[model samples]
Target chain A: MSADATQRAPQGRTLSAAPGSAGLARRAWPWLVAIVAALLLPWLFFDWSTHRHSGFALTMLSEIGLMAIFALSFNMQMGQAGLLSFGHAILFGLGGYCAAHTMNAVKAGAMWLPVELVPLVGGLGGLLFGVLFGYVATKQRATAFAMITMGLGELVAACALMFMGFFGGEGGISTDRVIGISLFGVSYSSSWQVYCLVVAWTAIAVLLMRLQTQTPLGRMANATRDNFERAQFVGYDPRMVRFCQFALSGFFAGIGGGLYAIVYEIVTFDTVAAAKSATALLAAYIGGAGGFFGPFLGTIVVVLLQSGVSLLSNAWLLYVGVLFIVMVMYAPGGLVGIIAQHAPIARAGRLRELIVPYVRILLPGAFSVFGFVLLVELASFTTIGAAQGKAFKIGPQAVDPATAFPWLLGAAALIGGGLWLRLEARGFRARWDALMADAKAKGVML
Target chain B: MEVFLVSLLNGLVYGMLLFMLASGLTLILSMMGVLNFAHASAYMLGAYFAFTISQYIGFWPALVLAPLLCGTIGAAIEMYGLRRVHRNGHIAELLFTFGLALIIEKVVQMTWGLIPVPYRIPAGLDFPLFTVYGTQFPAYRAFMLLISALMFGAIWLGLTRTRIGLVIQAALHHPEMVGALGHNVPRVFTTVFAAGTALAGLAGVIGGNYHVTEPAMAFTMGPIVFVVVVFGGLGSLTGCFIASLLMGLIQTFAVVLDYSVADLLKWFGFTVTSATPFHEVLTVPLPRIGALLPYVLLVLILVFRPRGLMGTRDT
Candidate 1:
């Protein structure tokens, strides 16, 4: 039915990166730019006096890189095949364990393997398990598919905790990343060196995933997603398509996990936890699961919110959850979808026409958002911060949550700003509709 | 034998709680085709609300009011949230609920803090009810059973005797046709969802003190309830009840038995020493892997029988 919905809304942009009329370079520029940006990111955070990158910045960037792969792989099942897997971390974590174990084996002098290609070992591990699990899980589709995946995830996580021989129990398995076996003689001792590996692998994984969408397997996946019965009628086994896509997605997820094991020098049961799976889902959905690069973009933002925002406030998850729900209800297309939706107007030279309307909405939107955040943070502070002996302060003044003043100010701002935003949103919508109409009349929008 | 009896009694209490939560989820999953991921979150909310209300009022009033408040919240979520996402399709709706679950957890944290609240068993029911195998069974367990049994009877009477229940039953089987017959199917959905959540809330009110009233409780209990629903088969209340009890007994027995496949194998003359391949799995105790059993059962059932026992629909 969801597939049917997507089919009905086909404005022929299912394959947004149409190979026709566009040169290869034009289509490839985004990747090129992204790669350059990623390469320079760590250096921008480098400390000249210490001759080192800020460990936090490097770690965060590396997380975004690998998590981008993970989130994208999650989308392979979700957006591509219309299969919602609740336990994607089964593959990701399994891959990490395999990679970690292999790394340990190398350290123990049992096997000689390049440290650089460890992600492939992880990929293989993921593929094998994906094949095994996908065989069982792909037997059912829709809701059942989700349930089975969830069960499988929980099963694996439980196993990870119980099986100390492999999972290493609560403390988890840790390793030194300076496994001197790289082709380039890169010992991978430094965090910067590991970050480079992450960047390279992330690039490869992203490129391969992008190319996968242009392949027959990818098309069949989309075909099955759009209409399962029709795909079956067209002599394609929707089950087989789902199975292959599931396995391949696992391979990519495993690669991400492999990199995770390397970057962190450990893989814990947390890798396979249900929360880990939720992270992928959050990234993919919030980024807008519709586009190839949507989840990739979403992963970057989600990881930032997770790693960066948590520093300032204990209510980061609340922010992410609120953002997620708001995105689901209002912007189902996600960040990528939002951008894709506006591409036509941007191309039509009438893009500037939306500036006034946008300003009208942004002011009140900011006001309400600020109020919401303040309220949420204050609420969180009373419970967590106050317990930790951290007082809620406004510059020189310490604010008390038990007092009525802050609460009233927060409530008043929230209510007033919400009403103002609502009023302005109406006008914004009208203006946006008119612009869209004008653009469509000018043969700009598809 | 004493251990068996005590575990059996304990399992019954746990099973009853699981059924209360799974019942609502089974209804939502089997009928509406929307898995209410926040069902357990609603249960958590009930505990929180009950705890706060119990502090101000008392446990008895809190028990009655908490579920009602949860039901109201469920109704609002259905009307405002699920209704909007319903047009987008099941995946969107699922995501919406998933987001709701996360939000509920965060909200619970923000409001109550991360610590477990003092939602304890009331003094009246805190005493032991009876001696079972020389061990006293707490009166709280008995109270849980009594409440659940009373709830079951009420639900049975209401559904069997009322016109609205008849409409709901019909709508469950034939939602579109029922809608065509001038019944508000969405309203039925809202009512059922609210009822289901309220049931979960009621379970929380009873079970929270028995366990712990904490935000993490929702997540810990969420998956097991799901496993129950899937095992019981979709759209079948009878199957759900049976599955819930079966899982409860299995989980409880697994913990108490202290038996393992290693022991069984040892009886069969195959010693599972550390020298043996995969010794870790072969020698692991049942209690160690108790958490894995329900999920293992779930996957096996899903693979072998898409439609659970007595299931009308292929889940």
Candidate 2:
């Protein structure tokens, strides 16, 4: 995650055009359209798509929204604030537990408030916990900070299981969201209805957090992150900046957690587990931690990979680990960095000229992808499927996995496709370089 | 009294096991500046490896070979994976280790299956050692104590008496200086990492049969090991030892005692029922909340003393 931001520092700094500049305006339109499309997605699915209103979409959407919030909140620390938290899920879980208890209280007639307003309680709960935890956590930065956060998270998670009053014990606690405020005169009985709430909260949180990046506090936090000694010499307390940022990030995470509680209507120990913390870390890292939207994009990609890929392979985590390692070592800026690398080309208005090259590259790429997928599927079918007492079939042919023929076929495809892709990539790069050189000589920027 | 004595003995045994894991972790962490989230996973691998090897050879042979296998794996990881990610800085290094941890878990699960492997004590060491205040202490526990003590002594000698150990001790304080002095720092790192992982593996080999050798064993033991490492401080071996034993004792003793917060409240003339707001907390006893005690101490230590007990520098 830090890799993305660190790499982008030189890029973002050197290219610090004004926010409202023409170049910026032109570049921002796609993002604006993307956000609009995202917001209008449920409506599009409800009205047009055949599989729009299925339970899967709603669940996926809820997951995306919650994780986006979590990732963005994580970015506040990792990207803007420069704190690498290994266990940011403490605030998320705290918010969840608080929301659970609040809902339970409401159910028991302890407090009367609309469900829409109840997330505020959760947010505040998170904010308070963040403040308390952050005060100590921010006393030291870097590795110490990471350790403290991890320790706190583990401690809280354990407490949640041990102390039944607050954490609801192992059985967890459930609440009803149906009794909450009627947004647009609609009680959230369905996942789609709940999605509306999620979208609204996600938007608000994202917007507010974006605004925070524009604030002096956020800028100072970045400065402090870049060079703490320099910041201290320049009359700013780095610790205070980190502390405030930690609390704010916790607030956003808490809001996300509240949304989680509302959607699931039940919160369990898994909600606050180390795996969840790792999820936010993965999402933020994969999307590219350089920009506000990087983590959001990462969350989408990760969730898609998580839900989509996990179904196909039990070794999905293995793939994720490999991806993370590769990204850290090679593409430090993640997907965003890859995109940002094309800035020079994009700015010269030569983006359209690369279409042929992209297509040329796509042939081997598609083959490589197919070969990889086949190998993964074959392996999964042999190992996991075998364990589950399932077998692979080809119409009337139920091939035995123990056969050498299948293994050889899979291996051949992988090797052949990989070699082909390597050759193709080299050819494409050579052609592109020649074209760019010719264009430069001809004085045709496009 | 018997319960208390038994709990103390159990806690001491657990603490010693924790030390074996945490001491190596402290060495690697302090010298190389890595938390090594996979340390417990290495321990788990040790257990699994022993279980596999013991199937053919004897338990005693498996004990020697399993840790060596684990140490080699650690060396491979440090050389291939970690060294490559090191250039990206500490966070990347951490993430790399974390990813390694996940992959290892999945791979172990794939190889071993989800069920707990019954890696029992050898018949020679299966009997009770003695009775402590009417509570029997198993021969295996005594064997564990002896082994840990031997490991501790060996580690002490390696650091104090041998040339390579002296190089490592210097590297612990000034890694770059050691490198400049012509002692291979990377070699030292590999050795320390291997040694640490070997310790963890050895602990797992012993604790596996003492506890259970399930795939989920890593996750269960991971946090406690971390707690011990943190509590012991980042660089200090003595601190690690004290912290490990303290944590072990606390957890064990807590599990033996059944008194809860409500018990204290009752003594203060307060009548409590299920309707109380804090009834859940009050009803849960120290023994039942044993799992939480380590984390609680970890947090307290982190908040109050971020450098940890006897740590020379902040982690």
lDDT of 2 by residue, B1-315 (tens): 877778787888899999998898899889999879889999999999999999898899999999999999999989987888888888888877877787788777766766787788888999988987777799999999999999999999999999998898899999999999898899889999999999999999998998999888888788788778788887789999999999988888877778888988999998779889878777877776777777677667777787788888766
Q: Per-candidate TM vs. native?
A: 0.96, 0.89
Q: What CAPRI grade goes to candidate 1?
A: high
Best model per DockQ: 1
Report the C-alpha lDDT of model 2 over A1-446, residue by residue, as the tens digit. Answer: 33334345556755776566776776667657866776677664563446457676678878999989999998999988779887799898789878978888887778887788667777887899989999978987887778778778877777877766667789888888887555467788888778878877887788899889989999999999889899999998899999999999999899988988999999888878888898898888878888779899888888888887786567677667666767777777888887876654544446677788788778766766666565666666665668787776544778776777766766777677778778778877886786566545544442
All candidates: CA RMSD in angstroms? Answer: 4.1, 5.0
lDDT of 1 by residue, A323-423 (tens): 89999999999999998988666655577888898898899888888778879888888878778877786658878878988888888888888999999
Alpha-carbon lDDT of model 1: 0.89
Worst 10 residues of 2 chain A by lDDT: A1-10
* TM match of model 2 to true structure: 0.89
Q: After superposition, how far is residue A43 of candidate 2 from its true place, in Å?
A: 6.4
